[model samples]
Target chain A: MILGLTIAIVVVALAAGALNLVLGLLGKAPNDLSLGALALVELALIAQVVTAIVAPLVGNPPSGNPIEFWAYLIAAVVIPVLAVFWALGERNRWGTVVLGIAALAIAVMVWRMQIIWTVQLA
Target chain B: MRVRASGDPLPLHYSVSVPEARSSLATGLGRVLVIVYAILALAATGRSVSQILSRFDEAPVAFTLSALAAVVYIVATIALVAKGPVWNRVAWIAIGFELVGVLVIGAISLLAPQLLGLPDINPFGRYATVWSDFGAGYLCIPLVLPVLGLLWLRSRRDAARQAATVDAEVRA
Candidate 1:
């Protein structure tokens, strides 16, 4: 994974998480803006999936466990979709909070992926 | 096949009555709790699976605890999502077990790390699982989640009871 892309994912995810968390706390319902930010996070995570696959093929296999890296990537991809389905069900402020939590989790996972990709585990 | 209460903003998909939706376990903060449980389940499952598959021999006790915690999280997540009394009881049991498990594991990890043989396989953290040292590895979320789950359960109990009564009547 490229450092730039990793940082970009982290920044966008955190921003999305913060946006949703504040809105949820304010008791705002789920709207396009809040959901769109999550959409963006999901898109970037999909990009990460592509990068993880292509980077490995292009001679950048992960320094850590491949299974671990892919496991985080797969989960990262699923979390947003799951949250979206969940928010669609609840259709309330708390659902927005779920979105926030999922985005935050993605951000954390992306950072871990970066480490797994680059840093050698002892 | 739908009913809507005045203040209850239920999903368009559920076929249940307004009362069920209004007083559901997944209403309000329960939704948030369910998501947290789901995430924790995922994390715990992943951690335990990886630990067990890759190096279970080094820290068998700790890895087994991780796997057990994973099972509890998965069960609690399902219980939170499901409706009715049986699921309610399951949720209480699972979350209650989680609370005890974390405290016990945390205490053991901190006091007697060698009981789980932590020193051998650990590369960085003091212990081998999510419940280690009261979830210190994951910023203590593991320690806190069960408490939150229990509180959420308490808050939802009456609603859950009412919902169960409605279900019973419908069945009868």
Candidate 2:
């Protein structure tokens, strides 16, 4: 992944996680704003997926274990959609908590992807 | 269904009105738990399959444990979402086994790596299972999840009982 794009994804995911966590702790359900933020994160992940696939042709291929990299990329693309669907059915503080957890997981996965990519290069 | 009070020839006009008993395990907080367990199930299954297929001979013990953890998570996720007494029993069994599995594996991996020949095949240079070192790789959620599951089960049971009592009083 491009370094700048990777950083942007991590920042957005972590910020979404923090915001959702605060809302959950306040006994609030996920509202439009929070869900919209998650949508943006999902869009970024989609972009990352495209970048990951194209980078190889463009001479910036990931040096990591290819299978693992692909697996993480697929998971990153899928988790947010699942979270949003699950959250939509739930209308309580716990619903927001679920989103928070999903956001945090995305952040962690992104960080791991970065490590997997960079370590092989090093 | 018909509800008969003790020593009453006539069935109680009121149904067995246990409102809480009708509540499924996947409501409210339980829904969140289901999502988390489902994610773990996917993660563990993928990791173990990849490990076993690519390098089974390298770390058979660790990879087998990972596979077992994946099964437990899958069962737990299903049971949490399924209805009826059968699913309730399944949830209890799955969650109970998970608690024991994590504790035993965590202890063994941390204190007795040689017992499992972990150092020879583990790429991480330490004994590692899904619960190794208290699930250090996954932020210790494995360590905490079973405990939370059991507690939630207990609370649901309590609520069912309480609702039953209330229904009985209303009938009386």
Tens digit of per-residue lDDT, candidate 2, span B20-68: 6544687888878988887788667766676676667866788788889
lDDT of each: 0.82, 0.78
Off by over 4 Å in 1: B1-23, B120-127, B158-172
- Where is model 1 chain B poorest over a 10-residue stretch in terms of lDDT? B119-128
lDDT of 2 by residue, A2-28 (tens): 789888999999999999989988999
**Each prediction's DockQ?**
0.39, 0.28
Chain A TM-score for each of the predictions: 0.95, 0.93
Q: Per-prediction TM-score, please?
A: 0.86, 0.87
TM-score of chain B of 1: 0.77
> Candidate 1, after superposition: displacement of residue B2 in Å?
7.9
lDDT of 1 by residue, A9-43 (tens): 99999999999999999998889999999999999
DockQ of 2: 0.28
Which candidate wins on lDDT? 1
The residue pairs in collision within model 1 are none
**TM-score of chain B in each prediction:** 0.77, 0.84
Q: Clash number for every model?
A: 0, 0
